[model samples]
Target chain A: MLTLAGVGKRYRRRSVLAALDLALARGEIVGLLGPNGSGKTTTLRIAAGYAWPDSGEVRLAGEVFDPDQATLRARIGYLPERVPLYDPFTVGEYLDFVAAARGLHGPSRASAVARVIAAFELDAVRTRVIGRLSKGFRQRIGLAQALVGEPDVLLLDEPTNGLDPFQILEARRMIRAAARGRGVIFSTHILQEVAALCTRVVYLHEGRLVELAVDGRDAGLEVRLARASLDAVRARVHALDPAIELRSAEALGEDRHRLVFDLGRAGVARAELVRLLAEFADLESVGEATPDIEQALNAALAAQARGAAA
Target chain B: MRGFVTLFARELRHYFVTPIACVVIAVFWAASGFFFSFNALFVAAPDMVSAFHNMSLLLMLMMPLVTMRTLAEERSGDTLELLLTLPVGEAAIVAAKYLALLVILVLMLAGSTLAVIPLALYGTPDYGPILGGYLGVFLLGAAFAAVGLAASSCAANQVVAAVLTWALLLLMWFVDYAAALDGAGGAVRWLQHVSFSVQYLDLIRGVLTRGAVVWFGSVIAVGMVVATQVLRARRA
Candidate 1:
């Protein structure tokens, strides 16, 4: 199991991640969903041991994940957002070096490199320099590099970013196959990919982790299935946070009033808004906040994270 | 460690598989040969002291180009991210790269060292100064390569890396001459002690002093340590 307890990170006065708590066990595929500048990359960077969190800690199998310890670091295979690879190196040569650096030696190193090459279907272009390969082949080569040592955990950042539809399907399949016995945390904007691949999801808004209900609940959507006071709920929301104004209240009769939150103008924390919604007991079945709204809310969230950091 | 050795071997392959290492070596040998032949033919004594000075000066300028891409290219290409994520210390990465460039420098100098055989063949050249001069040249190359590696890490691309490295090496080489303008005995001695060219003068004189060897070795160590720090800081 891998765990991040109260992990936080800041870039100058801007907090990129704040008080994140999460865990991953083997055979679980978790999707990290976030808008741009929401600290998804920072979270992955900290998790990958490439950067240290400003606060809290990460544990790998009950031990603190020390960056100084090669054995601990060897247990992780990371594919950064940029597809970090030497363009001039052949796929075979690159994987060979990755395997050796991951602590696989001699015959084991050769076998490990071979295993990933075959698994990622890189054998055909193993001799080809990465600079000359197509985007799909390059992406596959990046995957092969990460899978070389058969690590216990995988951290992938937008694995299917620039791939064609066919290549995207191939990459999705590869992620499924690769996560068979290892814990996988992948970040992607494609909700369909999350629905298709992730067993659970974590959302980041302005570098803060939004702890959505883990009992099969999405962060941004719910349908009204109960009768409760709409006016009382509106009063409570305003009282809890003055700037918040309930956008619309529709009467469903028999003491039921459907409340639709205008979160875009509210600039309220998701947790606070969810808490206000929970009080009504009439609201239920809300879908995700929606990625389309991601841009409109980016500034608000960024301002919020920066204000909190300050 | 396996990580260090792996990185080192990879860098060496990068040097040879491309035309980079061959071009650098050819140009280096041509330049050194031109300077040596000119000095040997034109000088009254036909000794290699001036030739060695010319070669060291040539190497001072060329070594950064040899090392400029070592780290800067990795950063620009996004490979540094992959390397840092590996289960290896920053020091290992720095050491492996610096050693690889230094080894290439030493190997290139071996070709120049062979020029001494011809110098000995044509005239009554003292073999002691030639041996000391070669040793000095090797040390000088390694030191400059280290400086270049440090500069590469600080740069965003290879051109900036090469320019920064040149600026740094030139400063170290000329600081003693700059100090001479001060005309104070104690300051002059101290500046000479710190100057790379002044340190090289001992070997050029066939003195082979321990202090100069230690000074060059320290420069290599300090330069590499600075490079390692730069690499580690980038992770944040």
Candidate 2:
């Protein structure tokens, strides 16, 4: 639903984003994964029409987006990283103001405010001043205001940054629910969040965009076994499929070791390897592996470093 | 237009909800009351010429207080991002804030009219000059409000905004005196042409010249445009 074509941004003599291109489609939750100063926030700000890119254009639904056209730009909702809010305003009042600012009026405005309050579970503190609320509540209100206008596109910067684990889960659910008919582009440093919540993910490094290619056929598995039997387990896995490669092996305290395997290049099913290892070692646990976000990130950065060196 | 109306209303509501507006309004009323009562009871003046003069000066000093937080607070509190991304243009945002400050000025000016009641009761005050004086002060307040908003847009904090506004208004107010110096020449005459005191005194003396009207109009326009441009430059 939104696209940034050859977008570039520079501050003084330094470039923050260079010839970056991205497209977000309806119902797609694209997680912008990058470390600090990776231009993720800059990309979101440009897409939200809050800032002008030094080069290229931003298009919404096939039309070049114009920041001056209030009515047309209201179709996209944005939540900055700081969660811009008026401390003096109550939760309901703030939502009402945002709803009206988006051009909704009278009954529609009231309904929009009420709908988001209910959706984000803000009814409890509806009348409390935002400044007096806790960080978690304030974050929820920020998310609520962005969704109050029911815009077609949502741009959120670290939407779950300050929330606790449960609150983060709630925020993730709220974001997923809000994405039914809208496109979402959210930035964050948490890899697990991207893995759990995103339909697609892209990493940004040194002002360049890199999309993580995940083939449906290739998978990863984690096996926990007695430490002494790790070598036996490895030998058996290679015997089954010589193409299988051990990504990493870590000791689990005194007796057990946890081994991660890249099942991508192997024809052997993970179940067969687990059963064969169980006969020789005391198998503690076996399950699909969570994508090692840190490992992947380090590899990507290292590859970029080598390319620069070459 | 919808965004402008909503923001305008929200700003107006905030002025009442916060303590700063109440304090400013209270201080204005108390000081203006003192000026009027001192003029009537102590100075034994039957006319409102001096009262309007004092009121005009009071507005010049208080307008910065009224407008200091309009844009400066948004910038400091980080709400300007939310505002900029909302489909509202920079011009509309500035206009809405300016209009809200104008409404406060209108209320204060309207309340000051109550002081004229004693003049109508005991003294045979000429209604024409009194009416002209009210118009004069309103225009002066309008010009002050605009300058204050411009200062708020440029400054990093409210105190700096207020100080910048005070410096600018005082310069405009004193330019007339500077033009009367012994060595003053053609350039000084040009400076006097833009002197706020000179234009404002004309309206107080019941001389509604086109030059004076245009002077205030230009000041208001320049202030609004400067404030709008500051917002635009930040986005760029």
Candidate 3:
């Protein structure tokens, strides 16, 4: 529903974002992963129409987005990294203000505010001043305000920044639910969060975007063998399919080794591999393995470092 | 526009809820009351000319407090991002905020009207000059408020906003003396013409000159436009 085409931004002598391209479609939750000073917030701000990109254009539904166009802005909701909120306002009052600001009127405004309050389970603190609430409640309130207007696109920066474990799970559930009929682009430092919440993941390094995965699909299996050597297990796994990729093999001491293989890419059936390993070594526990986004990102960073060194 | 109305109402409600607004209003009433009593009882003045003049000076001092947080606080707290990203134009935001401050000024003016009750009861007072005096003070307050809001948009904090407002208003106030200096030239005449004190004196004296009216309106317009420009420039 939103696209940034060849966008470039510079702060005086420093380039923040350079020729970056990204697109978000409805029902897709895109997680923006990057280290500090990687232009994640800058990209969101540009998409939300709060800042102008020095070059190229942003399009919403194929129409060029203009920051000065209020109508266009109404179709997007943004939660900044700092979670902008008025401390003096109660939860209901703040939601009401956001609803009205988005052009919801009278009954509709009241209903929108009520809807988000119910959705986010903010009814208990509806009358409580936001400043007086706990950080978790305040973060929920921030999320609540962003969804009040039912904007087609939701841009959230560190949406689960300060929440506790349970709250984080709750927020993830709510965000996943909210993305059912809308597009969401959220940036975070939490790798597990991206793995848990995102349908698509992208890495940003040195002012450029890197596509990491398409749908965070289960692409492999992680198996722990009780009486197998790392080299022997690797040799046997390779024998199953010469093209099979053994992503990782670790010696766990006492003749035990853990192996992770990209079974999907290698076209090797999980049962065939298990049967073959069972004949040579004692059977051990095995489970589906989601691609380790952290490992992939570390490899990408290492590759970049090597390129720079060369 | 819906954005303007929503923002204006929120700002008006905000003024009523904030302790700083209440304190500023209270202080203004106390100062205006003291001056009114001094003029009516001690000096035995039959009109509200001096009282209105003192209230105008008091407004020049107090308006900064009323407007300091209008834009500065939002910038400092990062709520400006939320506001700008919403479907609201900068001009509408500035106008709504200025109007909200104007409403507070009206409330203060309404409270000061109580002084007229005692004046009418004790002595014969000219209602024409009293009415004109009210108009004059309202215009002065509106101009001061607009100027204060413009200062708020430029400053980084409330304290700096207030100081910048005082500096700007004092310059306008003291420019009259500069024009009155001997051997002054055409530039001084222009300064005298633009001087806030010169524009406000005629209206308080029961003469609402078109020049004074236009001058105040121009100041208000310029202030609002400048504030809007500052907001736009910050987004860049």
Compose the digit string of candidate 2's lDDT tens values, residues A1-310. 8999999999888899998989999999998988899899999999988888999889999988865656767888888999999999999899999998888899999999999999989999999999999988998888888887789999999999978999899889999999889999999988888877888778987777877533222247787774456777778777766666565543334534777665543446777777766777787788876545554454455556656988
Residue A149 lDDT (model 2): 76
Prediction 3 global C-alpha lDDT: 0.85
Which docking category, incorrect, acceptable, medium or high, applies to candidate 2? medium
Candidates 2 and 3: which is better by DockQ? 2
Instruction: Extract clashing residue pairs from model 2.
Output: none
Ranking by lDDT: 3, 2, 1
**Over the stretch A138-253, how does candidate 3's per-residue lDDT look in tens digits?**
88888888888799999999999978999899889989988779999999999999989988888988788887743437457777777756667677767766666665432244
> Model 2, chain B: what is the TM-score?
0.95
Give the candidate order by descending DockQ: 2, 3, 1
Clashes of 2: 0
Clashing pairs in 3: none
Return whichever of 1 and 2 wins on lDDT: 2
Runs of candidate 3 exceeding 4 Å displacement: A214-290, B180-184
Chain A vs. native, model 3, TM-score: 0.80
User: lDDT tens digits, residues B52-110, model 1?
Assistant: 78888888878988999999998998888888889888899998998889788877777
Tens digits of lDDT, candidate 2, B32-56: 8888897778887656777778888
Q: Which ten contiguous residues of candidate 2 chain A have the minimum total lDDT?
A: A211-220
Candidate 2, residue A31: the lDDT equals: 87
